[model samples]
Target: MTIAHQPLFKLCYDEPYLQGTLIERNNRFLCHVLLDGSPVSCHVPNTSRLTELLVPGAPVGILKASNPNRKTAYDLVTVEYKGTTVNLDSNLPNRFTQLLIEHNYFPEFRELKLLKPESTYLDSRFDFYWERESFLAKKDPASEPVNGNSCLYQADTLTENKFAGYIEVKGVNYVENGIAQFPGAPTIRGVKHLHTLMDAYDQGFDAAVIFIIQRSDAHIFRPHETMDPLFAATLRQAAAHGIKLLTASMVVQGKCVTPTLEGPTIDLNPV
Candidate 1:
């Protein structure tokens, strides 16, 4: 999915955190400039991954989210500290969005009639639409209109209609040292999407959030509570309320992405 907002910092150099200190520690580096002025800290999710790109004395962007729960005012979302000024690899979450929509992992819903391949909406494009038909109560021959031939006749096609749905997909890649997990940090946006799906269900449509695990090591999916407790709570709520959550394990090497389902149906009903 597209970033709803822009970056807050340009680079990490001259940032308050590294103001007068020279790089002496093993973990610390003079990486880049933080011109976006977004309040930032070292403990944020996905931020640590940029260390490979944050070369000494380069330029990068820092965006801060206003979170009371955050230790620092900002969590670094992007960087241009590497050789190239633009880092396109930051869009991993957006790339696998379609795989999330089509497989009903998130119970993501969309109207089949309104869907087109690569159709863009809500800042992201989804996969194929999911459609299902629910039939009305069984028809009775005795209640049918009488035909002239003494045979009871009824309409073969019921007036009942089909249900439509829509959804956006996101790929999770912030697994640490090979452990596949979601929300390397607290994601308020993810919580918001869970709420959106719950609302969609109330509106008489099926909604889902599909997570495509790009690594082979992860055999199951679980909310990252340490990163974002609210997100985990919302996820449990979505399951209790009938929202569909799906996880697909995949093997990704280079540009190839293959699907492999290895878990039971995502159980949402409360025990």
Candidate 2:
């Protein structure tokens, strides 16, 4: 997937309201520039989740819409804090991103697995699994070829008829100015999830922390170090421990959104 005809907008710091003022009117708002210097606005749709982070003087990314009837002139997209502009309202975006990487539909993924309590422990049924295997096939003249090939037969590649590894998925919503960031707010739960992935790696299972970035403009992704330092630290630890850290972005197609992984990984080593 590709981002076509991305509009270029400016950071209107000259305007009085743009100069670190809050949105007092009904539909207006101030957004922040992302880590990559992109404009974003915290609009009404995102107000409930963004109000706390979008305080005065918060730098944001703004996209000027061509539609005159739209309530706000600019879309409030992200907020900058502690030298980082956290992308607010990333929930839906994250979901779309995950779909691109894993190719799992939203509905299928939700009901794909359930955790059942077994002996005081919650056992989770993973969404997917992976492994490396070699194929052993024999030529049979009477066999019909699969996919228009008449000579060979394709078969499942596994050992003892069981999967070799298990993996879980997590969606991410956080971006600014086309640059994706995670945890629009400080998320203790996110930190815990990283720890869980680390645990899975230790327990001989292949695990990953997937960030599905919502916005098409984000060229890259990073963890929100400013919002939650602990989460960042744990993410680094997860990487070091071999919990594959992955990311994918979403493509807006008409009224629908699709996930696509093309953005580079964010490196936030503790510094």
* Candidate with the greatest TM-score versus the true structure: 2
**lDDT tens digits, residue span 148-192, model 2:** 533223232323422233444444455555556666667766676
Deviation of model 1 at 133, angstroms: 8.1
lDDT of each: 0.44, 0.47
True-structure RMSD, every candidate: 14.9, 13.1
Total clashing pairs for each candidate: 30, 22
lDDT of 1: 0.44
Model 1, 92-209: lDDT tens digits are 4334444433444333343232333433223333443334432123335466432232221233423323244445454554444344455655677778777866765665545666
Which has the greatest lDDT? 2
TM-score of each model, in listed order:
0.47, 0.48
**Model 2 poorest 10 in a row by lDDT:** 113-122
The local lDDT score (0 to 100) that residue 173 gets in candidate 2 is 50
Q: What is candidate 1's CA lDDT for residue 91?
A: 39
Give candidate 1 regions above 4 Å deviation.
Answer: 1-162, 176-179, 261-271
